[model samples]
Target: MKRRQTPSNGTMFLLLGFSDLSLAAQTSLFVFFLLSYLFAVIGNGLIMLVVTFSPRLNSPMYFFLTVLSFTEILSISSTAPKALQGFLKAGRTISLIGCATQFSVFIAAVNCESSILTVMAYDRYMAICQPLRYTSVMTVSVCWKLTMIAWIFAFGNAVIGFSVLFNLPFCESILIAHFFCDVLPVMSLACGNTFFLEVFQLIMSVTLIMSTFTLIICSYVRILTSIFLLPSAESRHKAFSTCGSHLVSVIIFFGSAMFVHFHLGNPLSPYNDRMVALSYCVIIPTINPLIYSLKNNEMKEAIWKLTLKIVALHM
Candidate 1:
């Protein structure tokens, strides 16, 4: 493939992903990422399967877990394939429409993931603090509605943000200094005034992230209060254990995201930005299933039973 040295508006944008590194380094990263991407896909896929088919895991919590796993798969998949391709070849170009679509999907998936996490926290809150009302509140219909609302809001936000960004003229070079077409990098290439757009993006990002994170924090505070008030040590331990996986997941995801979005400085260099984004975008999703499964006894048992059933079928 020919390398594009110069790109402009209405043309393709060349992704310069880790091209500054040595060939050996790029190859190693390629291999590592390929394996990680596959593992993430398969791990999240397994989570969805177990949560869906295992009747033993029929609570609203598990239903939310299925939604999370699906969103994780979508989130990682948006960039992993293109990133892997970039590692193999130079001039990994994406058309304007293609880049816009990828960014849109990525934004939607990420926001959806945050929304689902917040909902999961609320689910836990209801189960622990309002156990008497949990069944009546978090019915199957309610769960489905919550999931739909998350997706709808996510895509709606993504469409609006990207539509404004893409409508701007681009007269500068179109070399994206990252693996994928991220908002900041793509915005850097636009010719017209982007201050308004940047402000708009910042507002939107903060609103989505901060709102969900605040709700999750509030839910956990109430949950922890209830757990502490429990009279029995065994019951308190059980309650804490139930929320352990989700707490860890929330920390890992939001920690990296906050660093990237709210750091006190100029924008991160391409290398640093890629490293930070790679953690939540790929690594977190890959290990999320393990976090939930290992922490939750019910999930572990369901997975074991499913594995046995699968092996028996093969035999």
Candidate 2:
């Protein structure tokens, strides 16, 4: 009789180190993530609603803002709920396909956001710096085309990234170290050597991130120079106020992103990895709508009107 080969221990599912988290800590994490998810959804949803209903927000800037809100909502939804469930259940195991799908969605949303932000900066430049030609330059057709390009670019990137992972044979290890199914964390679980894939992904990610960030920075610099040359104090103040919130949000999103993608080396500690992931994935999305709406007067008024209408309806 031929003997059957038994699966190795590494091939079997294990709890990994997350099982060591204290019960209180797990409970706290679950609650924290749950609240974060709710805020992310509600905040972005409100922004979408305001942009959709307000006639004053029918411009290109608000259109991009609506798309951004949608992207942020999708990005947070990709991982936060799963992480919360894992915290509550004390089980962190995810299937191979599930992890890959999560990563694909996340990468798509992130890449789309980067490109959309760059387009938004250009839109601001036209509106503030070249006001006379703004309407002509940024027509409805142009805006639609640009948005389509951003989505196509993001979808292509996601497809290519997932294709790379699809070819890899998973070893017995299915435990991902991070709270979410990030590329680095998921790649770490592959049984076979993945040095080439890791390097490729790192290069692609850095290139995309750096290029978009550079465009945003250059756009803002030019915008500032233009503002400074403005003869009217009121004009300068308006431009500064308009750009301030966007600048802060961009810094928070891109800065945290660059730090995690560029600074963190392989073989990351679980705690540090989870913390960094939470900052970008959970905290940033939850705070972005608040930052933008609070800073912009138009958005604030729109929200106020929306609230009044809802209250009046219930009366």
lDDT of 2 by residue, 25-111 (tens): 877777888999999999999999999998988999999898899999999998887776676445566665666677889999999
Scored by TM-score, the top model is 1
**Ten-residue region with minimum lDDT total, candidate 2:** 1-10
TM-score list, all predictions: 0.95, 0.92
Compute the lDDT for candidate 2. 0.82
- List candidate 1 segments past 4 Å from native: 1-10
- Candidate 2 Cα deviation (angstroms), residue 114: 0.8
In the predicted model 1, the residue pairs found to clash are none
Residue-by-residue lDDT tens digits, candidate 1, 62-113: 9999999999999999988999888766548889888988899899999899
Considering summed lDDT, which 10 consecutive residues are worst modelled in model 1?
1-10
Q: Scored by CA lDDT, what does every candidate get?
A: 0.87, 0.82
